[model samples]
Target: MTSTLTAPVQPETVHAIEVGVMQDRIIPEPVGPPSYRASYVTRDTAPGKARRGVVLALKTWGLEQLADTAELLVSELVTNTFVHTDSRTVGVVVTRTAETTVRIMVLDTDRAEMSVPTCPSGDEESGRGLFLVAALADRWDIERVSTGKRIWCELDTKKVQP
Candidate 1:
């Protein structure tokens, strides 16, 4: 292993500081959001892959109670990208916004805006992803960006049951 010495980190200049995995950064900091991001190939397994990442990050942050709901919601987002877009890969982010709140984001490379989610009838087999997200998440949204669309949902630990 090669080690190189560098200048000390001046608090104001470093914008993307990452705290150790097990440690929580003090709230109200100027650093980037505390998030875990992973990219998975767009395919049948993408949703599960995204879910596992969410579960792991939540558990690491000692927010185990949010993991299950977070997993289900994020999987829906990931699955949407895989099924609806021409994206080759999808990005998933699990962000801890507070001691009791978390945000999940799914991004893809297709620029088309997602159709407004509708609650399907009981006999419908498809179109339930966003419905599940809307019903389960504390809040959720869709944004069309330059590269593609970003779909995100938030959940608070206190609102979820273990």
Candidate 2:
């Protein structure tokens, strides 16, 4: 995707945002590669389980700074698997790829259309999942895999000296 910034579109232009990061977050990224993976039978409880798994991974890797956002993204992605697709299982992987970047991938056995981000109205509650994903993740995408499709996202944090 290519975007050309003109005079009308300036980075400093700001208005009231419904939701956003309240303050600067520093990741304190780890020194080496660390990762965690889990596969679950998709059910109503899958989202909660996935959130726990992500929290554990973030904690184990000493990236607790990312726990809140990471877990929420994982829950959203995992919930979409069982709720929108016929797949019985969902696979989640959390990998720390760099000193300041972590990637999350949710795989499911469905080749359905990739999830789309949307602007939901104030009164609507159901359509905001993907929107939240797009809003919070530094980068996110979906692609076709052999078994199905994978929706992934990355969350980057700044390194802070202690």
Best by lDDT: 2
> TM per model?
0.77, 0.74
After TM-score superposition, the amount by which residue 53's alpha carbon in candidate 2 deviates from its true location, in angstroms, is 1.0
Model 1 regions lying over 4 Å from their true place:
1-31
Please list all clashing residue pairs in model 1, or write none if there are none: none
- Estimate the lDDT of model 2: 0.78
The TM-score that candidate 1 achieves is 0.77
lDDT scores of the candidates, listed in order: 0.77, 0.78
Candidate 1, residues 86-122, lDDT tens digits: the string is: 9877878778888678989898899765677777899
**By TM-score, how accurate is candidate 2?**
0.74
lDDT for predicted candidate 1 compared with the true structure: 0.77
- 10 residues in a row with least lDDT, candidate 2: 17-26
Encode model 2's per-residue lDDT on 48-142: one tens digit a residue.
87787789878877888889999889999998898899987788888888878899999999877765556888998687878788989999998
